[model samples]
Target: MEPLAARTIPDLVRAGAVHFRDREAIVDGAVRLTYAQLGEEVNRFAAALAARGVGKGDRVALWAPNSWRWIVAALGIVTAGGVLVPLNTRFKGAEAGYILRRGGARLLLVEDGFLGNRYVESLTAAAETHESGTSDLPDIVTFDQWEEFVGGGAASGGAAGPDVTVTPDDLSDLFFTSGTTGQPKGAMLTHRQSTELYVTWSALAGLVEGDRYLLVNPCFNTFGYKAGVIACLLRGATVVPQAVFDVRETLEVVQRERITVLPGPPTLYTSMLDHPDRTRFDLSSLRVAVTGATTVPVVMIERLRDELKLRTVLTAYGLTESCGTATMCRPDDDPHTVATTCGTALPGVEVRVDGHTGEVLVRGYNVMRGYFEDPRATADAIDADGWLHTGDVGVLDERGYLRITDRLKDMFIVGGFNAYPAEIEQVLARHPAVAEVAVVGTPDERLGEVARAFVVTRGPADPGELTAYCKERLANYKVPREFVFVPELPRNASGKVLKTTLRSR
Candidate 1:
């Protein structure tokens, strides 16, 4: 009930079509939409990207997935003042042709054969196998000419919505990410740093107004486009997308969309609580979820509240240079404080931790206004006191709650102390046959580096009983001198764990 002084998201879709007009904003399967027909299909795709010339600050891109026409072409590319890059529907056309040529994207609007992969024949065979620098290639707009490109953008005689202004310091969305110099940079984000910090991340993840949500994370990540379609268009909820992530078609769309806000990634609620036809759906209208990890499994946060009766199961932390959120976890915390911490630090953000190397830094308006044009990797990631160091590793506690613990290039000194493989994969994800764990560091001429665990088991596990259950709860140089077990956990289509292909096996 509070989103309309809108600092642009096309003025929060024209003040959410006159304050949530007939609510139900987007359903996607049989395609429903409301909020005045999602503000007239995002003002007719921002009047067909201003009749295809697409001006104001340019840069378009958007390769599709999670539909409702990728939320009306990403709210019609920031409502035609354009910026919105997006891509990564698992990239690979030379990684979406180097972020549509390093974000100079003057238009792409793809979707050509989505999961069947024909994005303009894989960016024209990766620019004819020269694999990138697709010589300034933009202007494509496929997906069967999107309804004849929004039926020839009804030029002005169609009640204008493309005269476009978009302020709150413009540039609304660029994204990219992947950088330990493996390339892909673009971050940008404004329109008042994404409509004023996702309305303070949807009022610290409470996200009210007729809820419903369920967008299985992946609108080119930022947890599915800024906490899944701009926090479900600032709270008049109902989004529903789910293009992929099929735990039997997500328990039949949260038992036929009675879904009540289910954010993802604690292995998407441990693959819907180890789905064996999870008691035949009807997840009891789930009721808010959130999840984050480096370790969340206090018996899967007490079985997502005693077997999927989830009533706000949060845990959080962030990265994507902080716009993917920074910290969270307070829906009356406890489940071992939402499974070993990450909460706190979102209100005007500022986290800190480096008491000589615990890394986690941050500092607010949700960080990124850097990276996009690289500037020497944005001064090696926001320094000179504007903090944002974040090379991962964390600690914080004293009620300041953070936790994180690994990735100062995945720490690992051993025998000289400092070991963090997410602190032994958060203590081998509390064994009971560890279902998915990672930990790395393997090169040991007698402990110059040791911890090796890889594990994925959900049933029969024994590396000497998981190295005597991490030598009875870790600290013998944080156990695991080698565990291995596999069957899944290579991950990198933004699902993370590749711990450099498990330290090259």
Candidate 2:
């Protein structure tokens, strides 16, 4: 194994080439890339980008589904000394344009079409519309075009570009927050930060060689991209990428591939648990399951262990600003602890609860370098003492486990009483008919603000009955003032409910 200081992304690929040369690195149905083949592809892509004038400090964006190309592109960009900017594939034209322009991307790689949508055509239209006369518009390249560009220059002796020396502190990836409250800002992650996060998470999760990882979540999200894909690569584990989430198909893949590790949001676990064909698949091979992006309901965790037969069901907590994952429950944690706590901070990281407001603050190599081109916001987020203020209200238990109560901004003052959305959401999630729920503070003439819940129900249920159920457990002021039933809550690509969108509606 390479030393941590010497283990760069490119180094990981090179090591895998020698250790697991012919072993499967990534599998996407009919497509499979051996470690050696993937390493060669990474080198070729890196050379192609360097030939196109992409160098150190340049930003390259990848907007596509979960595929072999995504991994190759990310590794290529990093190896070429360029910063990688992964865009959410579900972003609309406006959102995509904003990210591209904000990041000042020199190049954009995307799929021709996915899920029947012409992403390349749509992105071109968006670019033309947004930057009609701009000189720094990004150069668009299709997947096949990119492959040809690299393959075309094979005999030119340019496939092996000049090796650029980079330090552990050099920026490698810029992940933008999901921006549930405000506009997104890029969180800069150094090579050391990225590598440390993956290494620590893999140790905490007990991931090892030959582990088959089923990756259904969007790789654009750091949780899935770094913790799942990157971690698996470092461990010589087989990565099975899913283009999109389909419960039945996911189950089938798990059985067919003998997938051992499954990491996704709680909503995904719920969907898999509720799938009618779930019992038909042989899921005994699955040993580890991780849930993040939102709080995991205790009932859901119980069902995951009892019914799904996954022995280790862990809950993780982190943000884009944390380089992916900062804290997560270990495999040996009790079920109740796993459900209630986000686990202790990973090794070499320090987590502290604010003395006054109980806001979670983290300081470590995993913390980001700050938001790109947003010094004021960065200053507000990271304190002068170098601790990244997470803005999440939490409490550290006696055992050093951190339990997130709610987002500080999401907590509201109702009739001069504080009401936390997570507390209310947890209570509502326990209701028999509630499938999904999001609580937001809406304007109230009497009180300064009141809680309003958007709920997705599994069956017929009256709002009055739900209110009565909450009143029994929660304080009168903390109970939701109104309930709005919906088919489903608005969620981002990672399956986190967008409370900001719910509030707007």
Candidate 3:
């Protein structure tokens, strides 16, 4: 067995075959690949990429839906010593083009059409209109075409490519955060940083060989790709990929595959909880169910464990700048703690609360190298002392648990009183008629600044009634002065609420 320290992303894939050759590595409907088979595909894809002028330090963009092909492409890109840049599948031409140009992508591999969106058409247009002088006009290839280019017709007897040696210091990926405040900047993650995070998360979650991981989140996001796909490879676990999320279909897949691990955002759990035929599906095999990207409602956590029969429910917190997961609720944590806290920092990571304002600062191997080609932003995020100021205001309880109060930038001062959106959002989520809420500070002459809430209601509830409900529990200044009812909160591709968008209105 290869030493975990010596393991790169490619090494992890090969190690899975040596340890669990017969175990399934990926299952997508009728398509199932064992560890050994998946390793072969990864190697072939590497050779294909190398043959097309992709080599050490080149950036290969993967703009596709979640599938076995996406995994193969990601591993292949890394194996060929190329930096994998996974773009959001939900991106339109303008957004996708910006990412491609920003990353200086040389090659883009995409699906034909996913979820009624013509991905191939969008990529083609983006490639043509890309205006970055530093970036090459990327070559576009459909997933089918790339497969054929590698070895669809000819016998698979091509000479094995030379080993692409990568040190821990080599950049592995460039993941862009879902720019809520400004333009998105790419977070540079080195091989060692990514591997360290994978190891820490695998150990913390108790993942093992033969575990079937059901992944529903978009692969473009660091949380989904690194935490789900990369972590599974490190632990020799199988991945059940979903091209798109459908509550009914997800339940069916879990039953049919005997899935052991399920990790996604809270919205997914809410959808599953609301499914009328949820009981009809045999979800007894589920061992660990994890949720993140937002606070998990206490009711949702309890129902998932008691009614859904999941053995454990965990919650995590992190960002693209922190290599996916920094803190994760322990398996043994009580339901109350999991609902309130984002958990402690993982091993090999250090987190501290700023003395003056209580902003969270993280320093560790899991932290990104920096924002790519943006020294100004990088300086603002990671100081000269090497600490990545996480901009999130949090505190460590006496028990060593970390409770995120709110984002420091998101905190609003209303009439000399502090207003944290997370606090108000948590209170609003408890309302029976409210599905979701986002609060932001808007300009006001009298109070200097006032809290305004945007809400998604479960039923036809009046905004004024909701405002009055808040006034009962919170101080007059803490309560939202204005409430706007919307069908949904504006969110980025990764399911994070876009406070900038809310503030813009």
Per residue, candidate 2 scores C-alpha lDDT tens digits across 294-333 of 5567888889889978878898888778887778898888
* Candidate 2 Cα errors over 4 Å, as ranges: 1-6, 127-136, 153-162, 178-181, 410-505
Question: Which ranking of candidates, highest lDDT first?
Answer: 2, 3, 1
- Compute the lDDT of residue 21 as modeled in candidate 3: 85
lDDT tens string, model 3, 1-505? Answer: 6525545776677777677788888988788999888888888888788777788999999988899999988988898899999887656665566678888889988886766677666555545655222224588778768658677312333234336786778898998753334355789998887777778787777787779999887788787887788888787788988987888999999999898998876667878888899889998898888776555678888988898787788888787799987888888998899888889888778888877449898888888889889888899999988889887888888776788876656766453333567756766787899998988988774444688999898899887788887764453566888888999888899998999899989
Q: Candidate 1, residues 68-156: lDDT per residue as tens digits?
A: 88888888878888888887665556667877888888889888886676778767777776567664577798867888888788874
Whole-structure CA lDDT of model 2: 0.79
| Model 3 lowest lDDT segment of ten | 153-162
lDDT of the candidates, in the order given: 0.78, 0.79, 0.78
- Candidate 3 lDDT score at position 315: 86
Greater TM-score among 1 and 2 belongs to 2
Query: What TM-score quantifies how close candidate 1 is to the native fold?
Result: 0.31
Candidate 1, residue 144: Cα displacement in angstroms equals 27
Error of 1 at 135 (Å): 41
